[model samples]
Target: MSTRLPALITHLAHRHVSVPGLLHSGFGGTEIDQAHRDVLDHLAHAVTAERHRVDEAAQTVMRGATTVIQALSHQMRSKIDEMQHRYDDPGLAQHLLGLDHLNEQNLRHIQGTGVLCGAWPGLTHADSHLGDIVAGAQSRIRGYHRVQVTSQMEAPVAVVARAVEPIAITVAELLANALHHTHGTLAIDVSLHQAESGACVVIDDAGVGMHSDETEFASRLLSGQRTILLTELGDPPRTGFAKISRLMRQYGFSVSIDKSSPYGGVRAVVFIPGNLLTLLDEHTHPMSAMAPLPRPTSPTRTGTLPTGDAGGTGGTGEGLPRRRRRDAQPAGHLPAARPDQAPTPEETQATWSAFQAGTASGRAASRTDHLEGNH
Candidate 1:
């Protein structure tokens, strides 16, 4: 028997109050009574039944739709690849091949959804370096060219096989979020740091950051119990953060956003607990401190910060200089290319050529002054 039951009943009896209406009737109960227990039990059972029905229907429909979408994305990618190979004009081929990359992104999104909704297959992998996973994720983002990767993780250390891709996927989603929200011209810095125990991957972007309330909501979503229903998502759905949240819960990692960034933008930090990491080389000592990788060229050709007011077109600036793009013409003729913007024929050709030739390695902008962008 509940210890408080007799007291609660006695108190309610003295007050001449019905327990069922205690809450809505504006008379709060200090203890639990039989009526309260019965009411809570009945509501719990009803909610459980309703929740099961809703989850079943949502999963069935979403899984079916995403599967169809996945099939189409694959077919589209094959045709785009074929077209890229056939075209002699570099510009035309570039235009056609851009579709292929977008298709791949779509496929990843669907697979992420499948993982979330309980349709995707089990995670599979062999041991891979944390740096390699970071590279894989950077390669998948839309504005990969604008991202700079700095890793102290060197070749000798590796994430345990089981945690590699999930970590990669979570990092990619964070990068995608940064790129999507910022002007494509801005630099996004992704850095890797090794803890004495685990590791951390931090992504900093020069995008409009989220509000406090938004952060709270996102925090709850990321760290909450895995009891969410599909219906709770928005109409078209926003699965980027949600997808990562699910993975973090399942795979034993932690994620936090906008903790620290020099650019006044969003900073996403992923904490990989020590349990998920291992040293690949038996002889080589894993560095407790980070070592810098080769830095990539800045946004400007001259590597001088562009001339603009702090609060002007782009955003914040502390006056660290960077050169302008060599290829960019006047502001009239030169439209700023963004990740979400459809690529022009010429731009596509240039990017595709870089990808094909394998000389297109981009760096993450880890420096603090590079945080702000030029208009």
Candidate 2:
């Protein structure tokens, strides 16, 4: 029954040998007989339990499969009917005929029943839910203007409950940053992979490249720096990169910011390794492993970030004492910013004036890139 009962019986035999040492005065043959009987009884119970568990699991799987197959069968028939009669025009007949053939093929596959994976319906539903969350983000950013935009996605998508939500938030943050920082068009690339070892999600955006120093500063957020004042501009809705960086840390992922392309501004990539999503086993190798695995205390921006090296004076702004500013810019410098909004600032009287004056737009852009200071 669990394939281990025989081994268990062998173990009990070893224990039976010990019985004689504890009961020296007992009749040797009778003692052996009782111990043998006890072991046999336990072995029987264990086998029965394993078999029952196996049977129950098999029945549940069959029930789920049947339900999905039946639903698929009905859906396929409806599709066939719709395709066969929806178009009456002679010119469209060829296309309709092809669709009908495809529909029939699908119907056959469903009716085969064997086509469904062992626990297909449940898996399908789970995948569908993840697809929706992913699609929703795509939909929200669909119409945002871009200098250039492109995307790629790969799958067997590890959609774990523990890290999924945090990763989603991190993705939204990076996507928004791409839209806000890039000039004309932006390109986005996303990859999700599950291997013999683990899983990973990689997102890349081509837009405005960030200064090597500043990008490193943001990335090292989790390593040695705990809390970062997100914006020079005042509080709440005005959250800057620091907040996003912290959130990524909460789930054991790190953010790397670099130039989007050979040409320009900033690119932020969020890397979630497989083990953080779940516990690893004997076979789990990291699919998206980073070399010199970062220590939780190491500055995030140390090596991969444009920020200065870990020992260099430049990147570790996190360790320096923050200079108090009595006349610093008020937190309300940009009132419309939010944790997930595209990096775009709301059109305000000041922004319009700057755009029209020409010089102001350049200066405003400069101030944005210098977010963490030229240091």
**Per-prediction TM-score, please?**
0.64, 0.34
Q: Candidate 1 residues 191-245, lDDT tens each?
A: 7776654678888777788879767657878875746566556677777778888
Candidate 1 has its poorest 10 consecutive residues by lDDT at: 365-374
> TM-score of predicted model 1?
0.64
Where does model 1 exceed 4 Å of error?
1-37, 75-89, 121-126, 278-350, 353-375
Give the per-residue Cα lDDT of candidate 1 at 42: 67
Q: How big is the positional error of residue 204 in model 1, measured in Å on the Cα after superposition?
A: 1.0
Mind giving the per-residue lDDT tens digits that candidate 2 earns over 1-375? 233345554554333332222234364568675675576577768865665566456645544555555455445545644553464454454444345445434433332222121222111111111222233233224222221121122221233444544454455556656665654433444433333333334444455566666565555553536433212213433333544554554557666666654334454555655444332111222211110111122333322222122222234334432212223223212112233443322332232222223221111221111111111
lDDT comparing candidate 1 with the true structure: 0.60
**lDDT of the candidates, in the order given:** 0.60, 0.38
